[model samples]
Target chain A: MSDKKISKIKIGIINLKTNNLYSIYNAIKNIGYNVSIVETNTKYLNYDFLILPGVGSYAKGMKNITENNFNKRLIDFILPGEKKILGICLGMQLLFENSNEFKMTKGLGLIKGKVKKFKFIQKTIIPHIGWNSVVLNNKMNYFKSSLINKKFYFVHSYVCEPADINYCGTKTFYGNKYFCSSIIQKNIIGTQFHPEKSGKAGINLLKSLLK
Target chain B: MRFIRIIPKLDIKNGQLIKGINLEGLRVLGNPFEFAKNYYESGADEILYLDNVATLYGTNNLSKFVSKTVKNIFIPVTVGGGIRNIKDVEMMLSSGADRICINSSAIDDINIIKKTSRIYGSSTICSIIEVVKIKNKYLITKSNGRDIVNKDPLEWAKKLEQFGTGEIILTCVNHEGLRNGFDIPLINKISRNIKVPVIAHGGAGNFQQVLEVIKKTKISGVAIASLFHYGLVPKFKFKKNRIGNFNYLDRVKNLNIKHTNNLKKLKLFLKSNNINVR
Candidate 1:
């Protein structure tokens, strides 16, 4: 997309009250797009793209989303699938059916998946923190080939397992396990890593995917 | 494979970037934002902002600094110093800090770690453990090494891990700023005892020292200040403002430190040694 075309794209970042929305906001704004922080009162349908950025526990995130009535608003906004919504880190996990973090918590269920904690393995740390390479699924060309094997910042203990393999957009290896790092189902997309915090490579990925 | 992160730790005092030896004798550098932007543009994996006097003064002024810096730099930024409560954590996070590092506050009340970690998830909270060795015993210090705690460094690290800390930044007070090398034995012990990722800070004088630390120990990241900052001293222009000590900036040219000023060079050097770096 041209710079003018990209600048015309309006992006809304949903504030779940549990995320550092400024980084993502700054990132999208740095990309020269019209971006705004979507609070509980903000209109969801105003923007062409919506980003669900979150940090914190699965239960707490869901509580905020449901309590603020964003659950219904988000489902309604994306019902037609013309607009796109991207979820990052905990936000990504919320798109699954349910998560076993702390306790069984029901998520947005926009996609087919379940979130589970990483099993204790020798020589591997919990809350897998640091930069890890994301091996993009070659069969799915949703992400640019340059993103393949690119390292993105990740800091989470839970992993999302989609019910079907077709939905997996990328896979990353941590410890001895390879889990889904990103998922794509029609207009809905989720990334386990913080692309906003992943430096230049991340910025390029966001520009390509969101633009 | 997991790529080890190379984080550039910028010490800020009175809104200016500062560096000290053994966590003392502070020297004023240029603007923190300029240094941070340079690091980001040079392919730094992450940026760490540590308020030099926040704990001593009982205040956190880095929120505005962090907000301004994050506007241009897109890497993961971790803000530390004077994070006494969840409100402070909230403030830093709201200001665009990806993670908040706590040392003095966590030392004051151990429960703060558990509370913040539970609320924000363990991945968002990083505990900084500054170590000072005395009489052959390693002790953890707080308030930027002003106060020493009567606890073993290894034990404290284990406790931090148990309390749900996402990561641990282990700073060796004796080895810091000297740039001789990292305390490999201490880093290896702490990392081996904890399940969470540990970032080794201090005593990184050159690229070889960094390579040694990562190769000798299981540290997930290396936080360097003097090596990276001193190498880039000539690049930044400092304003004629009185804040902290500026004598070191003038004498930096004569220091003759053997270091790679560019982060990409360090990454390339690491990669040549068969270490996974991004």
Candidate 2:
């Protein structure tokens, strides 16, 4: 913790050309951090934190990652350091091993998990869009103590299912299914919901990352 | 389950906020970004802006406004009106709108819904279903109530659900701006027939009217324009006086709609009534 504070903190937001690119940039800037918008062509990985924000299907999102070689650059950037990465919405799905959206698409595999669509009975709505509270899995006492169950804006039909239960950071319920809303594995953190869009609670999450 | 969303509907025309009765008699309201931020601070769950004249403009003219507001407001924003094809949807989404509402375009080509839902994901798309009651039967209408489709709304809703629409905005054209109340029977029928969440829109005279509609229907949210647009000026109390009646031009100035009855009171009212609100 002391060393983390001693080193100068640099935040880089990878530009995936998602819908919320500029909004995320402004939100982080408003939070009092001098953030950098790293374009796809640039290979600058000298940041303490990286945010991968995306919206749209897994196939298209993964295609952008592969076409632009963002996957290779991202993996190389965080492999040998105390650096952390945060993935929001479709960005979170991209961190998993593979996804079943549209077709079987491979993810970054930073965390061992599979992305699957929400399955429920006939009356249950797909895309579980809106503000839903997420419960911190008690297995991780750090999250349990700091981030109790709180509501966050979620707009997705797909969620991450980590291979190991220990990787599950937070869980949420939609319809009759309880799925992993977030994953915390060492320095990598991913949230199925958009923290930048979740208002105060969301801001708090981003601020926590800064600390 | 999560709380029901309370969305403030801002109708935009020619890059200015406007309000009207039954989607007619357009009256300027205020700046779109200011109103959106005020609503967000007051605890609005989400914001919806419909480009009232997007069809005539042949573009989502509200993209700049959406981008500007998304910087200050952290809540999700949905933009609608004149979304004709995949490119239009892409433009709006890329402009910082969390979701895109398709009405006239989806009605024109059902395949547009399929194509968008496939690429942008179902959650990114919301289908706005505006209906007009004709001889006790609810029929789907498009182009801002100018064109009526000879198809059952329930059938259309099912088709949209199958096409993977994230949700449905059921707006009653007759009840819109009339302030009578929501079309309860119409909302109930559509909400029950579809699997996706329904956003009950139009004809919300007060919090009570919203609660009444929520109580009977399976809607996941309520979208209000006149209720929020008119601010806290009581409906009958102001009209009864007739002393401060102003025309369309001075309506935004003369009326105290800007600073009156905010999102906080509305949320409290809904919560007090046992309606789950964010």
Candidate 3:
């Protein structure tokens, strides 16, 4: 797509009341795209892309989405497969079938996966805070060559495990184990890391995918 | 593999970026937004804003600046100083802060860490433990080393981690702004004992010290001030009418500081030394 065409694409960030949506909003806006914070009541069809941004517990994330009826709205919006959706951090985890955090909570089930806490071992941090490198999957080819082995900001205890290996776009190593960092299933995309907070590389990744 | 994050810590006081020696005698730098933008552009893994006077003033005044900085910079921003309750944490997060660093409040009430961490996940809460060495004992201090807490530094760090703090920012009061080096022994002890990531702050004079700290200790990141701040002093044209003392800005211009202003160069230096850095 041309720069002008990319600029005209309307992006609606789904507000789950998880955490700050401004970082992703500002990031997408900085990329010259028309973006807005859309709630469950907002018209999802108005935008070409819908971003589910979240940072909190999995149970609370699902509760807010179900209570606010975002789950229904999101399902309808992305069911056509023509429109794209992006899930960030806990937002990404909520896209799975279910999460083992706190209690066994049902997710949106857009992707065949489950969220589980990292098993603690020697020399492994619980939350897995700070910047870690994401080794992009070669078979996916969703990310550009430059993003291969690029470091993205990650801060979370639980990780998403896709049933099919093909859906795993990127994997990062921590706690002596590798977990899915990004998922790409047709028009659906999710990143466990905060690409908005990944600085220049992050902005570039968003531009490449969203554009 | 985990990349050691190089964070540029901007100490803010009364809406101006300031740096002090041993956490005292604050000197105003140029605009913090400009500095943050520059650091973000230069590949700083994260930007940390510590409101130097927030504890004394009873409220954090960095929300406006945090909101403004996050508009252009696409990186994790951590806001510290004077975060007492859940409301303060919410305000900072709403203002675009990815993480809230608490020092005085955590010292005043250790349970505040548990409460905030439970509400906002442990990863969002970063506990800042400012340490001062007196009579060969490392004691934890609050409010930027203005008040001394009777708790041991290592024990306090362990307590903070147990209370659900995701990260610990260990700031050495004696080595801050001196541009000498980091307290390696203290950093290693705290980081080795705690399960959460530890970010070493204060006493970063050059790239070698940063490299030394990371190599010697298990620190996830290094929060630098003078080494990077002084190198950029010559780059910015500070307005004379700004708040705080601008006199230090002029002196730092000619100051022979052996440091690289560019973050990429520091990363390259670390990379050359086989240290994984982003």
Query: By TM-score, who's the top model here?
Result: 1
lDDT of each: 0.88, 0.82, 0.87
Tens digits of lDDT, candidate 1, B191-215:
8888889999989888898988888
Q: What's the ranking of the predictions by lDDT, best on top? A: 1, 3, 2
The interface root mean square deviation of candidate 3 comes to 1.1
Interface RMSD of 1: 0.9
For model 3, what is the alpha-carbon lDDT of residue B122? 83
Task: Report the lDDT of model 3 for residue A31.
Answer: 80
Model 1 residue B181 distance off true place after TM-score fit, in angstroms: 0.8
Best by DockQ: 1
Sorted on DockQ, best first, the list reads 1, 3, 2
TM-score, model 1 to reference: 0.96
Segments of candidate 1 deviating more than 4 angstroms: A1-5, B252-262
- Tell me the DockQ of each model, to 2 decimals: 0.86, 0.71, 0.76
User: What would the DockQ be for model 1?
Assistant: 0.86
Task: Tell me which residue pairs clash in candidate 3.
Answer: none
All models, RMSD in angstroms: 1.9, 4.2, 2.1
